[model samples]
Target: MEEGATETPEELLAKQHRKEKKDLQAKIQSLKNAVPKNDKKRRKQLTEDIAKLEAELNQKHEEELKQLKSPADTKVGEMINGVEAMTVEGGDQQEVKQPRVTKAQKRRDKKAAQEKERESRIAEAEVQNLLGERHQEGLKLAQKLAQRQLQIREISSDGHCMYRAVEDQLVQRAVPGLTLVLKELRSRTAEYMRNHADDFVPFLTNPNTGDMYTADEFEKYCSDVEHTAAWGGQLELRALTHVLQLPIEVIQADSPTIKIGEEYDSEPITLVYMLHAYGLGEHYNSVERLKDPANEEDS
Candidate 1:
């Protein structure tokens, strides 16, 4: 009758069964005590009542146990079984299966892959074009400026260098290369003297014998010559300036307002053309002269 003091049907049933069992047990004990004092009828009634209560209790317990072990409780086990079936042979067969791509998606992927390959090819071609133009231009300029042709040689396993017509020119230009050459020559000389005194000094005396040392030794002596030729950089800077027909400072310095004819000042289209020509060793800042016949007469 108290508020919120309600027992559910299952709770009430359990409570009733407990009370009945307790009462039957008490009655049976009393009957046993009386049986020793000649109360036969009371003992028989109590025994019947106890047996009936016990039967009811057994039936109720069996029903409760059945409810506890019902089909709903086996759902987790069923789910596990299903998963094992899928992995081994059942639960999520579709999930275990490979995903299928749509025809439209496949087409799109193919198109994208093709586009990427095409762009890669175009980029490679552009770099090759630049290198080809530069090689040709260097060859032309070597003849014009050095009066000696330039030969592009792979002097190492992977490195490249432009030699002035002949390998001996490396020795002539060795004075201008760099401190790297100086340090290396000194190091090699020291190492050589330590290892073979007679062979090294005599080797140093012979200009060709210097070449007997590895490319690494020869490189340091050559670096200073190249550096001096550009004043501070390399012949490339000189070559670039000469090719662009611009002053050394214009190319070397950073400027906000680009001069049209100078390396930094040209229009975007002109810059591209100059880049191409500069690589080719024929840097021209303007295509305007080509467009204008009158400009040719003025030239």
Candidate 2:
């Protein structure tokens, strides 16, 4: 064991260069193994970093070769070996590996997400257009109703918009002692329709057979009107007019104002029928007098 051994700066610099090169390679592999391959931005950044580290490693290798060529610095230590020695020898301990998605798969998923967003935007626009049309109908109907100093009072659309709207007007006319108004009105209308079958029966066609209603079927129809929340329409309106002996005015967008029981001439119960007020089907809203003169609507 000779105690006089000494090392030159060139040899030490070459050892450091080898350690730095090893670190650069590990850093490049770590960058490649980063997660979330779908992140194009992060992938681009990693590509840049790997390129930079590789360039530096290449430049240092050239430097180490030129330094080691001198005969005096030829006594360098053995090359750093194995990933296990990386901590003491430049291992890049913080680097981790994760599974990555294929480029094709990532692109497909991005395209699908973009398509889904486009469809959502389209559906929203269609809904907005429908709302705009409903608003237009409201504005048009408002023009006719304004003459009487009345505004539309919205009725619930729970399959009984017509009956609920008629109930609203009946209450407004100060019909006294009206308990369970909708039930009472429906029962009265059905009874009238049943008794005056000659007037109503010829008007209704059996929906299933496309023929005139049989006696049993007409009775069932009346039962449904009173017992179930069956939707009300033209025939029901006519029956209601005779039952109450009251003129009923139906303001419509498509046709001239309908005057049911117009000959009665007492005051009219006013309602508006909207063809597209609801998405499912036509709907009715009751007419009420404006609360104040300022509430008068122009459109």
Best lDDT among the predictions, by candidate number: 2
Which parts of model 2 are misplaced by more than 4 Å? 1-132, 177-180, 291-299
Residue-level lDDT of model 2, residues 95-124, one tens digit each, is 323335456545644654575476457546
lDDT of 2 at 238: 90
Per-prediction backbone clash count: 20, 1
Candidate 1 ranges beyond 4 A from true positions: 1-124, 127-136, 142-150, 153-181, 184-299
- Ten contiguous residues with the weakest lDDT in model 1: 157-166
Clashes of 2: 1
Instruction: Quote the positional error of residue 102 for candidate 1 in Å.
Output: 4.1
TM-score of each: 0.19, 0.56
lDDT of 1 by residue, 62-138 (tens): 54444435433322223323342232333233434323556654564465457547645754653464357553443
Q: In candidate 2, what residue range of length 10 has the lowest lDDT sum? A: 77-86
